[model samples]
Target: MTSIQVADQTFVAAAPELAADVVGDRASWRRWWPDLRLEVVEDRGAQGVRWKVSGPLTGTMEIWCEAVLDGFVLHYFLHAEPVAAPPAEPRELTRVLADSNKALRVAGKVMSFEVKDRLERGRAVGAPATARSGTA
Candidate 1:
């Protein structure tokens, strides 16, 4: 019964804990999802957070930070349905769903890229990378 679902992963050249800090910012949440209200369902610290979304949509959203080569992969997931009644006609429903899907998709990408741009300022593109975990 989900009308819109966005699953995105963006790699950032920064520590997981650092990325978590950026993702956990309350002000940024309001800025990124002004139309939606999010209440924390779970706080995973350096990993990320799960939120119960309301307002424009009703469902669950999460950002999972997975440690990767020299950085972390920020996974954004938004599973929601339109708050208003969906179109009755098939064609209208398709159009509405597509538009909503695209909008949410773009929003997720923009948010992740902003984080990447902010934290990976000087990282060289195409550089060979390896995950930094445990002790050497």
Candidate 2:
């Protein structure tokens, strides 16, 4: 079986709970594999989530999403054999790996941004409004 591994880390300027929600939900997870159908296999709080994805490429991808008190990290491992023999050229393999890494990085950034926005909105709503000087 062929294997691929990729990892990315992001610092969320938000609380751990907010960051965890973005990384743990099904809707958010689907964004990573827009072309594939991903079903949640397991979701344990503060630990990880596993997903079974099937499409033109069929396999299970387990994403161990952990949230430290400071930030969040995602580690992914993909295992599958090509439907047909892969091109023998080394460049072909390299290209495939690079593309996969790029996709993961993009996904991580989106998740982090969403969490930060959510936290900022929550904070704004909770804070008291300040009166303008001499305007009232």
Candidate 3:
């Protein structure tokens, strides 16, 4: 019944609403976190998206994009437990949970860097921004 918490954030050179669009695109999830399956539990418009997670892990994940002076702050959180139980030993369960949490942290880090790279790379090279406000 214990939940592991994974959290991380990065800055992106895009507006909050634009960052949310990049984060909410389901087609990019697999490319970002291939081992995890995510379904939107709620979309917080310019704020971000909350998701129900399944696959190697089971629980909730949230990605928030906050507007900052320079651009956007992308935050990620994962509160979850391993889908498969470890060996019956209590210590084994603890170890498994720790390992899962570590993996989640790495995944979050990777996703954030990838997102930042994608969002900022174009801007760095003078390419026009592709991200647009979710609302017309």
Candidate 4:
């Protein structure tokens, strides 16, 4: 099984509510990635939780997540067989994967910083900060 592992540290503005929301519905992940479906395969309170995701990717991913009242961290392992051979050259595949990883890392950092900033603003103003920060 070809494997891709990704780790993301996310900060939620409403940590408590967000944690509850995430832990509440693993299936709801479909709403985020329309091409993917996630099902909770295991739930271990405090220690961690794991889920299986399959769809267009045609793979089983085990997402081990650790939750805290403020935010949660996720380690995802994607084990999938390519649906089709790359339309591009093999060298291109490496480049594509590198680009994808870079993009995801950038996105994760932006998202985490945004959420943290929003939480800070919310605390300062006593209201939720849902406004775009222009930076992102």
Best model per TM-score: 1
Q: How close is candidate 3 to the true structure, as a TM-score?
A: 0.79
Model 1, global lDDT: 0.84
Looking at candidate 3, what is the lDDT of residue 12?
75
Regions more than 4 Å wrong, model 4: 1-3, 12-18, 26-28, 44-49, 60-81, 99-122, 125-136
Selected candidate, larger lDDT, 2 vs 3: 3
Summed over model 4, clashes come to 0
lDDT tens digits, residues 12-106, model 1? 87767677667888899887888999999998987999999999799999999998867789999999988998889999999999998898888
Candidate 2 local lDDT, 3-30, one digit each (tens): 3444445443343444345557777666
The best-first sequence of candidates by TM-score reads 1, 3, 2, 4
List the candidates ranked by lDDT, beginning with the highest: 1, 3, 2, 4
lDDT of each: 0.84, 0.54, 0.77, 0.48
For residues 65-118, what per-residue lDDT tens digits would candidate 4 score against the true structure?
Answer: 454444445444555544545547888887766664555445435534543454
As a TM-score, model 4 comes out at 0.51
> Model 3: per-residue lDDT, tens digit, 13-97?
6666666656777887887779888888999977888999899778899988887765778899888776775679999877877
- Candidate closest to the true structure, highest lDDT: 1
> What residue pairs are clashing in model 4?
none
RMSD of each: 3.2, 7.8, 3.9, 7.7
For model 1, how big is the CA root-mean-square deviation? 3.2
Which pairs of residues collide in model 1?
69-130
TM-score for candidate 1, please give it: 0.88
